[model samples]
Target: MNEYKDASKESFNDDFCSYLEHHLTRAFANAEDELVQKVWCDGVLMPFFENQTSKKSVNDTKRIVTKAWIGQDGQGEYELVIKFEKYSLRKYARGSSLQDCVPSERTLDWINIDLARRTIEIQLT
Candidate 1:
């Protein structure tokens, strides 16, 4: 297990999210040298439903990594777990129609990596 404190500087844009993804990908790549050249990875963010309106769904805005770890389960499957700090970037300026809202940091979100399956799964809010 590894902790990545301040993995990146806080930003109003999605740059922080991109940085987290890049670092996570690198960690995945470094897990196993034998599978490095042969592995292919992909991921999906399951749609999130709003609590107030079940018919409406929420989208992810920004993310930052706080911790990560690679381990083998009882089944001998390698798994990578990443804990990320989430944020909501105000798309519109306060009291304005323009998309210029400041970014606000939120709580943590989790991402699970299956090295053997070459897939990533998000346990997001």
Candidate 2:
């Protein structure tokens, strides 16, 4: 059983890596413009949503409220804060069939965009 669990976990990681590689490759295909890449990456808080929350339905109401910013020291580091209103699961279910609907908790995710090397790194805290 343990061996099977380990294998399953490894498979999930492998699949996730493959998915990320494919997605990022497609996203960066025409990413010649720095602002375009920044906008595309920063426009949606994918990292935060992917890492912080276990609920998949949160994406329905979540949106990026701000743009990415870098510190004054030019450290190749960038940060963006996203804000969304909180809702209750019961309230959401009132009009929809979704269960466990609730106001999303305010969350902030920081991302580092390296324009020189054309790489994006997410910091999980």
Candidate 3:
């Protein structure tokens, strides 16, 4: 199965929400506006397309952020719902050099991402 196949409702609620909030914080890190703290990710309605590149056997995927809704709740918190085209792990090149398999050497050509979010979020204590 694909590595990202487990992006279920629970994952969206528990994982992706916080992940997006963190991403939002970083995206606005260099900005001078007050929008950063007011941002929050509430939910998602993701519908994935077939994994077109699965047959190719690479370990990265590409996604398109299709839509985003941002608004303030009646309460003090802000809410968000982001939509995106489903993504699957991208395929590796057939003629890649042996060293290319090293993660630091391998590049994900599918999506544009912030350098801070590029590092793994979970680490052993």
Best by lDDT: 2
| Model 2: per-residue Cα lDDT at residue 15 | 42
lDDT of 2 by residue, 13-101 (tens): 33433443334334443455455344332122234333322232434534222223222222333333322234432232233322222
**Tens digits of lDDT, candidate 1, 1-125:** 65632212222124433444444444444544444323323322112222311111122333322222333321222333222222222321111121112211121123345556644444422
Q: List the lowest-lDDT window of 10 residues for candidate 1.
A: 92-101
lDDT of 3 at 102: 19
lDDT of 3 by residue, 1-125 (tens): 65544223322323443454444444334334354334332333233433422333123332222222222231223222122222312112222222211122122221132222321121000
lDDT, model 2, position 10:
30
lDDT of 1 at 120: 49
Name the TM-score of candidate 3: 0.30
| TM-score sort, best first | 3, 2, 1
Which one is best on TM-score? 3
Candidate 3's error at 73, in angstroms? 15
Angstrom error at residue 102, model 1:
23
Which stretches in model 1 have alpha-carbon errors above 4 Å?
A: 1-13, 36-112, 115-125
